[model samples]
Target: MGIIRTTVITGLLGTSSAAAYLAARNPVISPLAANDPIWASKVFKKHNPSRNPVTQDVCIKRIPFSKIRPELLQNDGPLALEFCRGVWSGWGFAVQRRYLDFKWRGPETSQHLWTNEQLADSTYEKGTAITDHFEVVDKTPSAITVRCGDSPRNQALRPSDGLFEISATIDRQREEVELRLKSCLFSSQGKMDGVKGPMPSWMEELHQWYARIWAETGSWRLLK
Candidate 1:
């Protein structure tokens, strides 16, 4: 195991607000945009453009996508994402993301530079593990898209076809967002080959569950 992996294991399993996410009480989140054709039509596809590429469509109902702060959706920001990283523990996996660097090329460009400090997790810790590096591939007041690259640790292991990507967006005119995720083991091997699968249904359910917790944090959520 790497020093980075060893150091974050505990953090992944536990946090100061570990129990906060499990709390029963929460704020009222708007219902999914049942009538918004724009949101209904939006789709998420795997970034690894291979012959057999994987695609996923995420329509989050637990928390409205519009609820996501545009500022927090960028590749890097003033805030540290505070959502429960341990939400996946029930699935026998753990996840955490910490920013390494943030840069803006210029005022004239929408491109922003971002580096992730940590992307190790137990889900792919075996010979199939992967790392994460992200860039703001696209951005709008309504959306942010990011792509994940192999970490040095990952390339040493699954070097041949380890890559990933994700995009998240909310419509001011809708409730749910289209979340494109290919960052974990669920699709690592298939990333470059374009034979990947979407994150499982259970994982999606857990994300909604965690979204409830993240939503409850209110103004204290997803901010610096």
Candidate 2:
């Protein structure tokens, strides 16, 4: 019994070490800044009044406007769509999707999972559901915000309801275009109240790690 317990402990430690290494290597996702203007936006203000520390996160990439395609510079719609396509398609996302499928919590309709040309027709209007898991909750000339993870198909699969957003906008002060992915998880009460039941630390850490990997690889693919 002692030997068995030692072996199990060793295996668990090895797994945790590997996960930590991966997260450190790809640290892209980060906590949203306290003073970020998004907090003032009508959409964000409505959902996260207290700014629950455990529930919200953002991933960002900044690229010089000169490097951005000229056609996308003036058109926020195309820029957002293209970036989202890149966001959902990459080796990182592919690996995550496979894991979800293996766990039997993945999309029922594989055809509707990733980027498809049909998304090009999005009107970017409020309340538009796209690609099954994402819905456009807010749209402005400068940004588009989507609420993710509440789809009827995946709700049962997820431990909590959450939302994720992809936004691409010009940052005049920096002379760059900032691409950002934002996410928030809600308690069962349909509120950002972590008090109801806090997520396990390991769960949150795993999620952030995968998010960072996906963001890093996706941003690289977008630029390429």
Candidate 3:
């Protein structure tokens, strides 16, 4: 029998439709700094190894109608709001892939929560579930926080068992919304890795893509 290859198209995490006002801005594509040799080496290995290169597409957009802080929503157009969502989603996806093996829970149509069974199925060779629980720790009109286990991907990676803490914060302001994400992992092999960074490279590229879309369509005006 021939091998069946499947392609998973993990679409952008936020915003669906394009806006109608801000359409003239130029796309941004600045190269990452070369001074960080370690990061550069890892990125190069991940993207251009001798054999297979794992590629994933990223899209960013705003979550329309989200209850953003009134002050922030007052002046920014749809483009800005959607851009925030895209950034959040893009960063969130990177965090998930790095720290957890996530599966959908809470209704097929819902985007929140993953089922325990799904989590169980994603155990590492050492017999550990990727995530324990995802909780909404706090919320305000302008900001929210989501807390997960230290090594949320597998049960083997629990804070009580010397894991780290992971959380994400979304802060909305008059002109923009910032997504601050953090993850700490205490590996079973006695390794400690922590990340407090922006979204991945591909995600940044997607933001540029969204900017282009807004520019081309001239659709950044707020909807009534």
Candidate 3's TM-score: 0.25
TM-score, one value per model: 0.33, 0.61, 0.25
Q: Candidate 2: where are CA atoms >4 Å away?
A: 1-30, 35-54, 95-115, 119-124, 152-159, 188-197, 220-224
Residue-by-residue lDDT tens digits, candidate 2, 80-190? 766665656555555444443454443464544434344434455776655455667777665667765545354332334455677777777787777766766653333
Model 1 stretches astray by more than 4 angstroms: 1-12, 15-46, 51-132, 151-224
Best by lDDT: 2
Residue-by-residue lDDT tens digits, candidate 1, 5-85: 334434433664653543333322222233533222322223332323322333222345455566654542221222211
Predicted structure with the largest TM-score when compared to the true one: 2
Q: Show model 3 residue runs off by greater than 4 Å.
A: 1-133, 138-142, 149-174, 179-224
Which candidate do you rate higher for TM-score, 1 or 2? 2
**Scored by CA lDDT, what does every candidate get?**
0.32, 0.56, 0.29
Q: Is candidate 1 or candidate 3 better by TM-score?
A: 1
lDDT of 2 at 179: 76
Error of 3 at 220 (Å): 12
